[model samples]
Target: MEYQWNFAPIFAHSDALLVGALGTLRIFVVCLLLGLSLGLLVGLARYSTRRLLTWPAAAFVEFFRNTPVLVQIIWFFFALPILVPFEISPMTAAVLGISLNSAAFSAEIFRGGIQSIEPGQWEAGRAIGMSYAQIMRRIILPQAIRRMLPALTNRGIEIFKMSTLASVVAYVELLHQGRLIASLNFNPIETYTVIAVAFFLFLYPLVRATYVLERRLGRSD
Candidate 1:
């Protein structure tokens, strides 16, 4: 069967698609901020001298890193309420799930960046009587963060793509909105094509940014 090509349906609901796209972007931004903050803390904790602190952070990173994000999202959306008897909106659950899952992977990225710094840098900081926190905050973290920017931007693209999974929990992100339009119009091709274009529009800039930063850093190195 030949499919008829029609972009009009997608354009007809551009307002709704825009709303959903904005919602997806909002979730992505919030989750990225929260995840990056939590990842930094967890990364530091994993490097702590205390085994108690380090072990928990290690466990968290391992568990989330090893598991699929879709499974984690399902657990948060479906199982959490059953286990804890507390209600969370689907959007909230989606954001929290994505943030928490992203945190684990990002923690490892941060840890790698931190470890890649030369031992001499740490010794230099300590030689100057810098406290551990001061050393990390002032010297190590700044350099590590700059080094990790490309990886972090890549993760941002991943998170934006993963935001589509929010539809599973009934959060009306772009994919969800597209699916709704497809269902109503019986035009899956156009709906999905638009969704794909929208996703590319969102992710391509981050990819370019990553490339630019990587080149800049490589030049300096």
Candidate 2:
């Protein structure tokens, strides 16, 4: 027996899907900004000579990197409210988990990019009477960032997919909305297919961009 494919029901709930897409985009943007920004600070700490900074930063990176992101999200949503004074909403929990997880990963990318620079670069900056901060801001980061572009782009793509995990906590992302449509219309096939297509449509260009960035960076180097 062939499964009769029906999409009309899914189309009927287009408004819900649109809302879900918006929710997804919101979480993705928030996580991307917070993650990469925090990652830079954590990466700088990890790269520091001081043990005080390195120790805590190292622990954070290790903890997040070693643990599963899904668990992080669940813990933040379910367990954190007990310890904190304020309530942890689905958006807040999703943001905290995904952002911190991405931060741990991006920190390594930032650290490696910075370390890939030659020692002579630092020496040259010092010879020019530049302070550590000045050298990093003006010289090192500029060069390192170019090399890190592809990796960072890939990380952004990953963050976009990670937004779906928010659905587990009923955060009303694309997948969450799809689930609602599936359960109601009893058409999981058509519902999930649309969701998959939506994801592919959104992510394909980014995947292509990552390849382009790699090629350009390759030629530059």
Candidate 3:
């Protein structure tokens, strides 16, 4: 039998698709910001001379990094509600789970960037009588950010892709919306193909920009 490709049904529900994409972008941005802040603190802890600080951060990174994100999302969405007085939304679960995971990786990126700085730079800051905090704030982080940007941008794109995982928790990102529309219209191929193309179009620029910046920075390694 010859098959007809029908996209009309999906486009008829364009509003839903748009909403899903927005939700995806929302979670992606929120996760990136949360990961940045949390990862910085965690990275700082990992770099600390004190074992007290390093151990917990190391544990945090290991737990999140080693665990599958799907399990994390499910646990947050389902298990946490049983333990807490309030209900947890799937969107919140997705954000928290994936952001925590991203934070673990980002922490490592931050640690690497921080460590890559020359020892002389640290000593130069000390020679100026800068406090540890001042050195970090004024010297270390500024330099580290240049190194971190390409990796972080790549991470941002990865987080954007991972937004599809939110669908498993029933948070309606692009994939979830596409799935529902496909089931409704009996055109899984058309629906998912569009979603895949949309993701590619949305993400390609970011990946390209990161490549360009990495080349410019002479830190492509």
lDDT of 2 by residue, 5-107 (tens): 8899999999999999999989999999999999999999999999999999999999999998889999999999999899999999999999999999999
What is the Cα-based lDDT of residue 186 in candidate 1? 88
lDDT-superior candidate, 1 or 2: 2
Q: Candidate 1: minimum summed lDDT over ten consecutive residues — where?
A: 212-221
The digit string of per-residue lDDT tens for model 3 on 45-164 reads 998999999999999999999999989999999999999999899989999898999999999999999999999999999999999999999999988988888888877887888888
TM-score of each: 0.93, 0.94, 0.93
Error of 2 at 6 (Å): 1.4
Who wins the TM-score comparison?
2
TM-score of 3: 0.93
- TM-score for candidate 1: 0.93
> What lDDT does each candidate get?
0.88, 0.94, 0.90
Which stretches of model 3 miss by more than 4 angstroms? 1-3, 211-221
Which ten residues in a row are the worst by lDDT in model 2?
212-221
- In the order shown, what is each candidate's alpha-carbon RMSD? 1.8, 1.7, 2.3
- How are the candidates ranked when ordered by lDDT, highest leading? 2, 3, 1
> What are the per-model numbers of colliding residue pairs?
0, 0, 0
